[model samples]
Target: MSSKRERRWWTEEEDQILKAGVESQSKQIGEVNSLMSWNEIAAMLPRRTNKDCRKRWYKVRSDFIKGTWSREEDRKLQQAVQQHGLKWALVSRDVESRNADQCAKRWQHGLRPDLKHTPWQPEEDAKLLQAMDKHGNKWKKIATLDLPNRSSHDIRNRQVLKQLF
Candidate 1:
């Protein structure tokens, strides 16, 4: 009897074949209830598994929604920030329909400088102190007045509170 070969990793060519096959099959299976299973797809592309095809399909969908930030995308994000003034949520939404977390992370890291800064301004400090003094640990109320734009609950636990109180 002949020896069987062990399965190996997929190559670029295999990936292309899998992509084409999935596209073709998906078109045919359109709107059908309980369409082709991953196992069937894998059988069609003998070298891969249902799991592999599923994973690749998920990755492709994610990439399409999140759109890897190209130089052009970065430029657009920057321009959006300049034009809209630190509307990171809006900019991120426009950049990619999915991966909002990824876009938010990019913005926080200064990969998107047009996003707003979260520095503690002196006026904010003063207002927080005043509100704290008046309310006596009423952080939520103080934050609303002192930093209306900020989520005050988060700011209540900052090191600045130690200095102020």
Candidate 2:
């Protein structure tokens, strides 16, 4: 099998080219549709593939929109947590988009206030057992209903069958 070549980062010149092309195309099309396809944009640039162009486009858009997280934002996030036990999602919405896993990690890492400890209640155990009985191993869906706060990894670890044959 032939090995794929490594991708290079976009330089300032390429950024200029992409911006100019997008601007001109948008004006011509009377909208941004013509400029939205990264593959078409890549075809106009030198030595870049559709994937590379798309990745760079997303990065540029994110940096331009968010302007990177600042020290002041970090300070505010910390203060919000200390003063009112604010959720990371609420505090960091302006600084960064917090997905489910990121929010969990932020809480675990002490970036947010510690979540109240909630042990698996008896009813939760019964529901999990019943779901497992019906589904035979659809831990993800079962976890969603029975342990909404738990991660898939956590649910997997807690599975009795996971420890058995």
Candidate 3:
């Protein structure tokens, strides 16, 4: 086998450290002409070169916007979405720790009142069809008409599943 080690995925903790290092170095640049080189960051991590550390940071840069989601943040998101409608830009700024995309996803998938959390029942399925007939794929409107538990997300999901299988 070669002496070179195989590359592995960076962990969340590693990514956090990498981001902090970059940010810290940037902030310190004003006070000092010198800065923490990529060499310094690489030295902090085991078996990584300067290039490797730099490349890893860039690779996962988008992740800076998305991190852990707490129930409190979820509640804030729901309130923000409810107050502002689907304006992700507004909701994202109001709800800290989540950007626009994350806020939109959480609303679309889970927090929205239009999405029912439970599995579909036969009665619910029958109602769904009636609502669909009346509304014609306008899931948000259909949801408000009859289904108390069902959200537009649930309706859309059920509709697709019905059409497919």
Candidate 4:
């Protein structure tokens, strides 16, 4: 026998409660950490687990920036990459309003100087098809092993483009 919790989106009231709880604790301690803070916070929301509270706090936090990247941000990302060489946490500090994961993705997908942006040739498309057939949907493997100049994002998009036409 097994038990499963109901699945649903976090409500606005729940988000407010989570935000207030996290902010209150952060103010008290200068930073919120340890399982104790989360456990205490979770106690307030009977339905939520400690892990759920922590994850939702990250999503609702004011510093969680999103949306299109600016040219200035791109320039900062380039400089950060040069200075830190893939230490993404350090790189992220130089680019305002972006996280380490965002910084790494921006560099890998768009900023890397060596990334080939030219139109795909017919031969390359043929090669992409063969790689897909051989490897299924493993875009990273296809990008790395078969199309070194392309990112996994590009390889995945190409397959989508193929499907449309």
By lDDT, is 3 or 4 better? Answer: 4
User: Which ten residues in a row are the worst by lDDT in model 1?
Assistant: 108-117
Q: Which residue pairs come into collision in candidate 4?
A: none
Q: Is candidate 1 or candidate 2 better by lDDT?
A: 1
lDDT of 2 by residue, 1-165 (tens): 759887676789999888876677677777443135667778899798766765565456543234243556556556655654545434434334432223334444334332224566677667667777877677667656655656544556667644584
Off by over 4 Å in 3: 1-91, 112-115
Of 2 and 3, the candidate ranking higher by lDDT: 3
lDDT of candidate 3 over 115-164, digit per residue (tens) = 56887899999998998888899987887787866767778888999999
For candidate 1, write residues 1-165 as lDDT tens digits.
759657687778777877776777778877211254667768767767776776565455535455466776667666656666555445554655433344544554445433224777787667776777778776557645655554544456653556676
Model 4 deviation from the true structure expressed as Cα RMSD, one decimal place: 5.0
Clashing pairs in 3: 114-151, 114-152, 115-151
lDDT of 4: 0.83
User: TM-score: which candidate is best?
Assistant: 4
**Position 160, candidate 4: lDDT:** 98
- Candidate-wise lDDT, in order: 0.59, 0.57, 0.75, 0.83
Model 2 has a clash total of: 0
lDDT of 3: 0.75
In angstroms, the error of model 2 at 50 is 2.1
Clashes of 4: 0
